[model samples]
Target: MGYGLPIYHSHCRIDENNQMFEEGREIIYVNASIQEDTALGRLMHDMFCTDSRDMHYEFLRKRVSYYKENEGGKQEMCEIWEEIKNKGKLEGLREGETIGKQAGLAEGKILGRQQGVIEERINSIKKLMRKNGYTLEEALDFLDIPKEERSTYIGIFTS
Candidate 1:
């Protein structure tokens, strides 16, 4: 959605296991109330996708001056920070585990895309060979399909 200060549009439809496919779309929203520069706020927004209120108390923790002007505000901020700190810790652990899974999925997608490009090139070579009266094996040789990967190339084209 909008990329303004109030980033409330964080939603994604996907499989339960956090797999990101080509067609999959994920929206992560950062809360408007929290300042983007704060440490806890940045962590929650960048990692856990938390909203403004969740990060507000964390921001308050760093600024003790605000507490003197508004005593109740200080107490309230402290209480909220204590509660969310625990939640943030838990979310941090989960994010650590998910990071590896996300990285693996991304690598797999990259490999798949590279293979697809290779397969397309092989098909184009095969067509050129056929037009020029060359056999499949001869055309494959002309294209310099590596001997080690001939089977894979053939499988892709034949399939």
Candidate 2:
């Protein structure tokens, strides 16, 4: 692992050549610290970024910004959690019983957790709206929800 520069991606292989055989195994490692000018270096830097604003790549930064700064992005991330839940379900099922049987069990657990977070936020918005006598938009704005993502919760916000 190397740190510094804007970003980089780590690449690993058994040897310098493109041989896939298990022979003359020579580990190849390209230190990111020295490869700061390369694309991989930038990718590595992007991976270590804690905040979207700190990211070096516009593509990665924009995507992260969508999830962090936008409320719809939050919901989108929850859906991603559900997808991971399904994949995780598949993984655990591959270890035990038939894939179909255990699929729902594991997937739902992750989905439920994500949904719980979404539900909690929704409830908070509702609570603020009722207690503070705020409109839906005002309540969402008060909670720092991004304007672009506001339309996503319109229906749910009403009922």
Candidate 3:
């Protein structure tokens, strides 16, 4: 029979309990292997090969075995790992510093605007007090300022 679609195959074995009561068919086993010339095979070979000193293959078999078996090699791996970690940490810190500076500048602008409003209100309260001959407490009360925050306004305007 000629099949129109691609046929995929795999190696499989049936267990002793493999039984289909309705059909009662005996299971057959088959195995398939990929050719080394295939793309996946080539990629695996390139990644696992230890014949070259390429930095991309940092976890080569020989280097891994050497680091496991020798203190000097282990120390070298530790140092390399530490250096990589430090580089990442430094980058994160720089990013955090930039974000912090931006937030600080935004907060400074908001506080400056609030101070301007407070200064305007203090000038208004002072005019009311001088023009109407009202006491500091009376002026603050007439302006509807909270008693707790009155001292802050007083300190700023008086100074």
The list of candidate 2 runs beyond 4 A from truth reads 1-38, 90-95, 98-159
Candidate 1: the clashing residue pairs are none
What's the ranking of the predictions by lDDT, best on top? 2, 3, 1
The TM-score that candidate 2 achieves is 0.39
In model 2, the worst 10-residue window by lDDT is 2-11
Candidate 3, position 36, lDDT: 56
lDDT of 2 by residue, 1-159 (tens): 534334343444547786456454455455544436467777767777788888788999999899878998997786567556544644563445344336756755555565555556667776786589788888888888777766655645442
lDDT of each: 0.57, 0.65, 0.58
Decoy 3 TM-score against native? 0.33
Error of 1 at 155 (Å): 2.6
Those runs of model 3 whose alpha carbons end farther than 4 Å from true positions after fitting are 1-104, 157-159
In terms of TM-score, how similar is model 1 to the real structure? Answer: 0.30
By descending TM-score, how would the candidates be arranged?
Answer: 2, 3, 1
Give the per-residue lDDT digits (tens) of candidate 1, residues 9-76.
34454578775455455565765446467764566453443333443445543344455346876766
